[model samples]
Target: MRSILIALPLLIAAPAWAQGDDSELWLTATGEVAVADKTSIELESINRFSDDSGGLYEIELAAGVKRSLGDGWYIGGGYVRVVNYSRGTVTRTEDRLRVQGGFSTDAGPFKLSGRLRLERRAASTGDEIGYRLRPNIKAALPLGKSDFRLFAAHESFLPLDDTDWGENAGHDRMRNSIGVSWKASKAISVEGGYLHQYRLPRNGRTSATDHALTFTLGVSL
Candidate 1:
């Protein structure tokens, strides 16, 4: 636990590459099943589009299992695969394994949480290995007498290794988002939000900022 806490800051200080400025749109679908009182299985698929919803650029599929540790603490692990498309051609693919842990607590009329995740990534370019760390915090406010809640979150990712593509050693990406979640039914919920992302370059290029409109549909079974 102490070592994990110490690793968070170190990972943020490592070196990375530039993504030119752009706006994007994202749609995500997610489902979860309870295998036990304290354990659950989760799955998600996401689609990413470029500015003006002009073109499809990326798709991601992920699955994972999570377990409660009691008292608002939890641990989970997952695998993800992402495919990138550009100019009507499949350009790159990334496969990643991730382990994460977090804690949540309630304050008056709100819930707050923090999470830490570590990842091992392999890309199709050369199938090289790289590592990453991500830390984030979230807040939720429930609307009185309604099944709607306001959500806000901020997260940052740091690359930890040098690969054939480039050195992703420093603060690579940051995302700030705000959204509203509506409980449409007992087992279904939807969320819509906007995200602002900032990215730094690894190949000595200019950095970029991306504005994105995001929507998610979640179902629990």
Candidate 2:
């Protein structure tokens, strides 16, 4: 446990070791409500600010529902509306539909989880539908008996189908984050982290990297 805790800071700082093209901030508010036994609904709002994109570059609003399948397994799906802005002007909008399933389990003092997501994305700038696959894993460890926990997560974006609006059918990008979560109360938690995003070079495009400070406020009811 001590070794793992020591490595968490390295994982968080690894992105900064690379040459990042942009600096950004991401803020998210998420809430979950139990509607039935073993079933819940989640709603999220995310706002992102970017330096190169002229600040306040993106906004996402999403809602989803999940049903626990017993013994640490679950399935869910949701819709997201994404709006892109440049220099405070709205540039494009996107609609995304997602279906996902995953599992979670505890290993000694560590909690591990993984999920796979399938997405269908449609953009206002193009008629071609884009299909994407995202797989992610996360691990968390409690800070002794305190209400704070340390966590690290990685997610990959793979484009399954090509589209005119810059979707190249291949490995697209990845996100890595390291952070700590605080249980502020029984129903509220807060998380703050450093997130690194790297986009693979494809279709004559140069690779891009983003360093972001991320914060999240989560509520459960």
- Best by the TM-score measure: 2
Q: Please provide, for model 2 over 1-221, each residue's C-alpha lDDT reduced to its tens digit, 9 standing for 90 to 100.
A: 64454456657666574567898989999999999999999899999999898889999999999999999999999999999999989999999999999999999999999999999999999999999999999999999998888999999999998888878898899999888888889999988778889998888989998998888999999
lDDT of 1 by residue, 107-202 (tens): 999989999999998888875799999999999888686777778899999898878855468899899887777788989998877777888665
RMSD for all candidates, in order, please: 9.6, 3.3
Query: Lowest-lDDT window of 10 residues in candidate 2?
Result: 1-10
Colliding pairs, model 2 = none
**Pairs clashing in candidate 1?**
14-169, 14-170, 15-169, 15-170, 16-201, 16-202, 17-201, 17-202, 18-201
Model 2: runs farther than 4 Å from truth?
1-19
By TM-score, how accurate is candidate 1?
Answer: 0.86
